[model samples]
Target: MNKSTYITAENPMSATFRYLAISIMFMFVGFLFGKLFVPASLVYAANIFVVILIVGLLIFSLMSRKNVIPTSFSMNFVYLFTFVDGILMYPILTYYLYDLGTSLFINIVLSTCVIFAVFAFISHKKPAGYFIGLGNILLTSLMVLLAMTIVNIFFNAPVFNILVSAFGIILFSAYILYDVSTLKHYIESGRITCKNDLSIHVLNLYLDFVNILLDLLRIVSDLKD
Candidate 1:
């Protein structure tokens, strides 16, 4: 299929959102499959698989960004990756669902949606360049956060974990604003001229939403403890 078959300059935003919706749907399907069919005994193995998949996807995304990979292929990869990711989320989701109960789980999801929507709206109103400039600062913060996470693994301190989770919430919240603005800039500047480019934006938004949900979940769990 032609690269531009689904996307057009006039309505790139709509096309991107459509792709995002589809990706999220695939993730939900994967989550259900994992929750229902997968044995709890395999959760550890699933975590290993997910870690490897994440690394692979990161490499693939880098290649796609450099235009070394075909856009069509990259788009398909995004969907598959998202599905696997959702399946892997089974363990964490169940923990939260069971521990917090159905109502609280729903509330957490609603809160995530609200946070995502607010940042997206803010991005829409701001000039893309403003958020684009934040790219470096966010990346630096992310690296520092990763280092802290690694250190916490050894110490396993509750206070440290809480601090990291709090930092993560702030970092990823900024990321949502940056990513949404970047997507808007890409569409407006004609950088996203094909359907394939939409995959990256879909993945970015998905990660942003998921990360924020996770950080919120951790915080809530800590509070409960």
Candidate 2:
């Protein structure tokens, strides 16, 4: 194979895997820092700043130089996002970690990995566009769920809470499928340039993984209670 072809085709899946690993590692790093070093108040304040900064950085990166970002700068953004995210999640993770124990956290991690692997395999085998329709449906469901969540804050509906968690589990699982499917399509179609915009997919998968784990944790904790 020519150098360019090899560069493009040689283990496209590697990008996906690398991004996933980095994401998980950063998440853990953030989790530890948040849990041990940062207070809730500081994390809350930093949360707002980090989120805006990360989003702005991502947008700028995508818009510049054929959608390619400098590795150094991109890495910095990734680290910052994870560190801040960890800090933000510390309070919630602390609650569940204490109530549910570390074992449950491990279980959720393993479970999410397996589930994502299965979907990745499917995405590799299946053609793209298959999940687009389902993704749209899930997106709509997510929107309504968000609305309901806002309402629940004031209404404090127990049933609605369980329903949201259940639906969140399903929605995020489908998101994994959609994202993997989308990733495969973009890689093949030359839209995503796995080398350049891999961060985009990484962020997408990380969000899916975290959301699924959180929802699963919620359901399991409720059942245990």
TM-score of 1: 0.84
lDDT of 1 at 156: 59
Q: List the candidate 1 regions with Cα displacement exceeding 4 Å.
A: 1-10, 42-73
- lDDT tens digits by residue: candidate 1, 109-157: 9898898889888888998756888887877777677667667656757
Compute the lDDT for candidate 2.
0.64
TM-score of each: 0.84, 0.77
Residue 2, model 1: lDDT of 58
lDDT of 1 at 71: 42
Task: For residues 117-197, write the lDDT of model 2, one tens digit per residue.
Answer: 887677667887667667657666666655655565566555665677788667767777787877777767766533545
In terms of lDDT, the best-performing candidate is 1
CA-lDDT, candidates in order:
0.72, 0.64
